[model samples]
Target: MQAHFDAQQRQRSKLTELGLGLSIDIVAALATSAVVAPFVAIIDRSIISNASGRMPLMAGLQDGFRTLATRPAVLARQPSVVAVFSVYAITYITANASETIALSANADPLLPKFLASSTVNIAACVYKDKLLTHWCSLGPARPFPMASYGLFGLRDSLTVAASFSLPPLLSTMLQSNTSMSKTSCDSISQLALPCMVQFISTPIHLLGLDIYNNPSATAVRRAQVVRRDFIPSTLARMGRILPAFGFGGLVNNKTRTTLKRWIL
Candidate 1:
């Protein structure tokens, strides 16, 4: 009889443990879904609207506001809610926005441009010293230290590419008049008034990324070196890039109009 009672207690404990774990998992999944759903909805709506030549901005605004309102409450109660929202916001504002702006403006696509420029610049910088040493060690003196000069030239090439690509992309994404898809716009409108709430809340997402991914000392040191030594030269080579990016709205308008005409 005692053995039977002990067995029963053991079974009960096991069941309780299993239930507890399952409960936690369920809550986690629910939280994740809640955060991701908004972002996914926004992206899907934006893409459909853009592809169909409809406006999606209102929808974005609506969604943004709704998210802002609910976010604080959800985060206050559950910390994980904060993380999920942060990821969604970053993905939407940074990656998705860049894509949208690029497509709308008819500028070089953001992904390809950023990838190509970053690759070239990183490669040239990494190899600069090595290449110079190889050339200089060959003899008393080479004709003009072509390798060292070539590194500067490669860096210049990267700057030119970045400048050409960054302006229109940023402009189109940030423009106020750009529209969202009908579905997304509807979703936004349904959220209620005071859409600015979302905009105010959006910065939280940016701050999260900066806090989470901030560089270590090594990274800061390297960036500092790059900025000090390489930035000026690159800027001179690609002067047009900064102007275009700085006057984002104007560039966006020009790029979008040009693309629209070309496509039509």
Candidate 2:
């Protein structure tokens, strides 16, 4: 009787695991579609519009200049907006790449894992290079914005948290072939809940930045003209952070073990 009960419990656990996997697959598909659909529509419209022989390469130049000239003064004063957006962009790219690396590591197709890791490394290198270039270009006359630095720190925290979570979730999911482990199942559930919180926080962050900074024509022109200094600064920041990340990995034997196992 006990053996039968155990078998039944295992069967129920497997069913639950299959259901959860399906749900995750569905959500991932929808999330990707939601992001891609608008991009596709915009690209399609651009292609269709440019297909006409009458399309002038500089047709929008006058309008663009005019829009820039008329931009609000508040935006010019609020450097925090640019800083916040830059930080968010950096964090998002890093977090997503890290997540992809973790998830793809244990995938059945070796190609996916290789591609994901390659892409992430390339992106990180590029961003770090950009950050370094930007920092070097900024002369002594132009001081670093304190508010921007603060915002960047906050964004980094978010990125680190997200990056840390991905490994555990991926490891948990890949642990059991039959998916009967309650701990593994619960990890995925917990991982998903934070993403929902991130979704909610994003709009609030955007709105807050918008309220403080309204885009103006002059600000737009200034942005276009200003040599990006963020790139070099970002690279330097990464140099400091990467060592710490490596140290943490070394200290956490379980994480290191999981990473190595998945990599192989």
Best by TM-score: 2
Q: Write the per-residue lDDT of candidate 2 for residues 1-264, one digit (tens) a residue.
A: 999999999888766644544344333333332332222222212211222212221332333234335753443233322332233233333433444444544544234433443344334433332342233232222333434334333443343443344445555666654455755454443344334334333332222222223223255543432223223223322332332222222233233335445533
User: Which regions in candidate 2 have their CA more than 4 angstroms from the true location?
Assistant: 1-145, 165-194, 207-212, 215-264
Worst 10 residues of 2 by lDDT: 44-53
Show the lowest summed lDDT stretch of 10 residues, model 1.
204-213
- Residue 5, candidate 2: alpha-carbon lDDT: 100
lDDT of every predicted structure (CA atoms): 0.36, 0.35
Residue 222 of model 1: what lDDT?
41
Residue-pair clashes per candidate, as listed?
8, 13
What are the per-residue Cα lDDT tens digits for candidate 1 across 46-143?
Answer: 32232222434346335544764678454334322333334322322332234444554567565654554445433442343233222223234223
Residue-level lDDT for 49 in candidate 2 = 22
